[model samples]
Target: MKFFCATFAMVVTSATQAEVFTYECDTPPLSVWEVAGEWCSPLESLKNGLLIHQVDLCPGWPPPGGQFVFYTRSLADFDGAATFFVQWELQTNGDSSEFVGVCPASLSLGSFGPVFYQIVIARDTAKFHRDDGLPNIYISIAPDVPHTYRLELFGADLYTWYIDGMVVASGVPEGAYPSFYPAMNFGTRAWRLPNTTRWNYIRYGTIPLDAAGDYDSDGSVDEFDLSFFVECLLGEGVPSGPGCGFADFDADGDTDCDDWVAFQAHWTGPPAVPPIPPPCAVVGDTNCDGAVNVLDINAFVMALSDPSAYAIQFPNCPMSTADANGDGAIDILDINAFVALLQ
Candidate 1:
């Protein structure tokens, strides 16, 4: 009944190039996972402008049995707003699966090519029920900041939604999680995403992982990694195999789910994972086995250069300590040290 959200703090990148804010949740006081973003884009269409309470989320996260929740207040698009919608992303690997959240969706009164926004109410919450039946959950953004957004989603015999900190809506869509119905997604086909919309005070809360390093997509890593690993044993992909980032928990160049196991082994508490050892005389016990091995060593390497990538490699590993050389926690200095060891 009592769950903690991911502790996140926004990292306002650059106002000139959009930014992402982060805050940590479930740290003790208020374990609410929250991240905010103010950017244009990051990847191809997935700009680095990831919102807070959601931006820094682990890709292909929540594994299978896991659950996740993010809140975006300011979501703006590039091309003229014609009516935008976000996809749940059924499968980042190849399925390109997706769904839409339309109820709380928005409509713009202003005119802006690349802009959108929303705000999180104080007493907003999502309640889960055992029954199957729910309405759409979405908020309508307007110049009026003092307004409220009500939302609800249905599974099958149950609905999930909260109103002003109350379970206004409850039930699961089709009696199954979105994972079960990869193709099912809500949308705002009725209204269009005008070229302009703004949001503010966005908040989020959730339990992202059942345990650390559960990147196998089955939720928990444990022995399941063997299955996801077997599936990608011979595969080769950056961070992840053909399945995207599900099994590449430790990014040790080996496609497997063991990464999730290692992450769970030393998570200190929270959705985070174990930490990869430093690059110096440091032990690469990233898996928290208290020894230096391929997993630790490889994860250590990723730590020096790419912190996020490093986290993905060894989810549980303390990526904060990735900086071996100490130039700046997991900076070029650490990379140099790691590479030196390779040479």
Candidate 2:
């Protein structure tokens, strides 16, 4: 019962943040995926979603090795907090350590440091590995049946794992993996046994576990978040641009009425008045002494020629003020306008 309550809490938390990426596996995932060994192409299926049949194991020790591995070609990679959701099934479970699994680990063997988590069917049972085997938790999982798995990582030290909407683990200590790329594999490189796995879908992203509608990230849902919420309300369509995430309360790719409903639930009246920040420095006034003069020339040149140096020299000045032409960028194009401003 405690586990069920934890599971519900996790599900609710996850539903509040939008998924950054998803692979349905209904068609070729070539745009996002790279595969090794004899992994068959994804095929469309009505009941199964998409079926990826892992062919017989590889023959030798080098190169492709024994396992059939499919991993993303590239990843933006989440920082601080992340959530991974996958619906899949192992069609065959072998007697040996032959297994099918998904994890946030590099393809290479020697990469060190903690991995966020791993979910696998190794010896005819499902196992979850958190933060590089802090400990392994095993549970009974039947072969040839699809199950949804959710793993949520909070910062570097807390995580929760769920299987088919039930929490198997929660608040597990995490050692911080830094960043991760999702990977799915069938048969171990060590065991070399064959198995077929079907992946229905996979979705992952950075998610805020608290303050679901806090747009400015000031830690409360209040008046300041309303404008961002209104801007992100796209009804049934996908929300775009920055700050849309703040309004995606249902995490369904769209900021619709449902999201507005959720957003209202977190509303905490008007936000507290924040302390005044340093004023934005005038353009060409790189020294930020409240005047644009010849004395600003050296700093202006530094802002143009050596941005990093300028940043160190004028740590309090706004970088945007360096955009002398108001072109919204600090580049060689701004030099002419800055020189004219000096004259």
Candidate 3:
């Protein structure tokens, strides 16, 4: 019941024939689930329309081993600031790629400055952003501009570079950790540690899935956090004040006690919704808006090409303060909506 795909042409480098804007999929109707389990990306057959270089990701895009990368196995204390981001197209012919900030597998391939891989921000029960198993190695660079790197590792010994976001080239240059059998990279690579530089389409992983509610990635964990954990089990969502504690974990809240003892987590692989009650059913969400961007993809393509007899229910999420193409997916990269309103 869903087949929208048209523009797809990728050949960035078969030795530089350079066609870059890829996503034309459909090798012969191969991936067919059209609904439930959600496979669907055969590029939907191509009727000549898929050019979403607005960097699409709805039904399928970036689902390929990308996004959802979380790694922090070893770090006793580096504590700098470390950060992450991805999303491009500054008209992109390739906008001068060099982004590979966050390395630390133990610094060997030209290890320079800023390498902290420690994920123990723990506050535990209070949920201030729990991680506190304690040891410490954070990096956090956000100088903005064209370059920002963070390579580090000490549980084994490796470190690399970062400068505009600050950590200024702190190498250890010798190398280790990467050969786990091919790849699982963090800070994701298009090339930066040793230097290649198509730059970065985006890749990040350090490995942290103790239970995975993804904390609050907002990528998707529907039923609205089990409908806000059944509205915090029926009390109606409480526990706030700082970071990640909407239910203090499995007690009656959003999966927390290590995702509540880690049993039947979610994303069950089917039942994407629809017991029936959705005839375009959004019903004046008052302000909950879901997928419609650029302050709302041309306003839902001009509200479905207006003549608006009426179709309400879209509200929340339309107030981006110009985190500006920072590309972190706070709604498909907060698309600048040309930085103003519509005409």
Question: Tell me, what's the RMSD of every candidate?
Answer: 19.2, 17.3, 22.4
Which candidate should be chosen as best, given lDDT against the real structure? 2
- Per-candidate TM equals 0.25, 0.45, 0.18
Between prediction 1 and prediction 2, the one with superior lDDT is 2
> Can you write out model 3's per-residue Cα lDDT over 14-92, one digit (the tens) per residue?
2211111212233221221112112222121222221111111234333222121121211111112122111111111
- Of the pair 2 and 3, which is ahead by lDDT? 2
By TM-score: ranked, best first? 2, 1, 3
Best model number under TM-score: 2
User: lDDT of each structure?
Assistant: 0.30, 0.51, 0.25
lDDT of 2: 0.51
- Give the least accurate 10-residue stretch of model 1, judged by summed lDDT: 89-98
lDDT of 1 by residue, 1-343 (tens): 1111234333222222212222222232123322322222211121222222221223344422111222223332112211112111111110101112221222211122211122122112211222223333433222322232322222224333433323343433342222211211111111111111122222221111222333222233333233323334443343332222334556565543354345446334333432232221243344455554555665665565566776565664455444445555555656556545444
Tens-digit per-residue lDDT, 25-45, candidate 2: 345545455655433332223
**Candidates by lDDT, descending order:** 2, 1, 3
Q: Scored by Cα lDDT, where does model 1 land?
A: 0.30
